[model samples]
Target: MPIDHKQTYDGNNIFARIVRGEIPSKKVLETEHSLAFHDINPLAAIHVLVIPKGPYVSWEDFSANASDAEIADFVRAVGETARIVGAEPQGYRLLANTGKRAGQEVAHLHVHIFGGQPLGGMLAR
Candidate 1:
């Protein structure tokens, strides 16, 4: 446990609260290691967040030590989330902001699934 997992998220971390059942979410899909739900602040017609259940601060942290099973679970959750957002048979953008510089406001590791229309190019400066 190199990083302080407890400090990774405070009580205000909405995803953490959702996972803990402290708050209700439009849960679209889930697995032993991952959970998917609609984004409260949606950027597109269909925007969802796919998050891992482990104590992870960001994508870099999760990818660095995620087991094969954990990685598979995350990816499967992403796929399921895409389907839930109607991004499957069509397409979508998957976003995982790694750090502050990348616009990751939440410490909990999550992948954003957004689509249902012509999305913007990318994160602009």
Candidate 2:
């Protein structure tokens, strides 16, 4: 289920906790503005979640509030994480679900990197 993009950032969300060093995650890469970690429940062989270190509820929020440096760092972090996870050679899908219909379970903005095998159609038929 997706969450309200306008909702205030939850400091206790799993990603937030992970960023704050309260929850443990299989970290892939950590930069000043972003953190990339393997998803606990992966849908693909190389599923990872790249999230900004700042408190943001959704992509819109992040885009509207995050600094230019933060945004640039986050973007680079996603690409770096994908390369580090060996997904570049095989191609990968970058997904950032926003709004209620997109199935964004977590309130925090995260870009999912899915790859390592044929992903088939972009959406189920």
Candidate 3:
């Protein structure tokens, strides 16, 4: 157990709350290992957040601790979310902010699927 692991995987995060059914979210896709839902503050025409059911704070934690089956299920859920949100036709961007500098607000590990229109360039410019 490392300090980063301890700091990153704070189980009481907002997404963790959502995973625990403590916070209501408009779900787009749900599997046994993951949950995909609409973002509260959407940045694109279609913005969905795909999160693993397990407690994790970043992609590193997920890759390090999750089984191959869990990872596959979670990744597949992202694609399913994109299709349900109508991002599968044109194009989509998957975003996972790992740390504070990257604007990762929630401590729970999640991927943001954005599409349905021209997202333009990156870095929020």
Candidate 4:
């Protein structure tokens, strides 16, 4: 999907405020490249959001602009966050909503981690 760059990373979005420490969040993990926090509204017993520290509209933006080390660190944070939440043993779902069609409400690039039960499927077979 083609992302609307104008709508991608709005500084007023909640994520941006959280990243700037302007707003409070139930933070779970923070690394040099990423920040992991409990979603204010969770879809599962264990739902967290892992986002890059820098301004990024979507995964494509991050992948295209960030350095190799930054990308690696961000990905590492997601895995580390899952372990902290104890979702590793039972398995978890890591999802990224890219564009409007994918249901990306927030413009900033973030990965949603959900678990605590069998999530079944999101697509029709």
Best by TM-score: 2
* Residue-by-residue lDDT tens digits, candidate 1, 1-125: 12333244554577788888899999999799999999998989889999998777777778887888988999988997787668977689999877655667777888899888888777675
TM-score of each: 0.86, 0.97, 0.90, 0.91
Q: Looking at candidate 2, what is the lDDT of residue 9?
A: 82
lDDT of candidate 2?
0.94
Off by over 4 Å in 4: 1-8
lDDT of each: 0.81, 0.94, 0.86, 0.89
Clashes of 2: 0
Question: What's model 2's lDDT at 15?
Answer: 93
Regarding lDDT, does 2 or 4 come out ahead?
2
Summarize candidate 2's per-residue lDDT along 1-125 as a digit string, tens digits. Answer: 67877888889999999999999999999999999999999999999999999998889999999999999999999999999999999899999998788888899999999999999999976
- Give candidate 2 regions above 4 Å deviation: none
- Scored by lDDT, the top model is 2
Better-scoring candidate (lDDT), 1 or 3: 3
* Candidate 2 least-lDDT 10 residues: 1-10
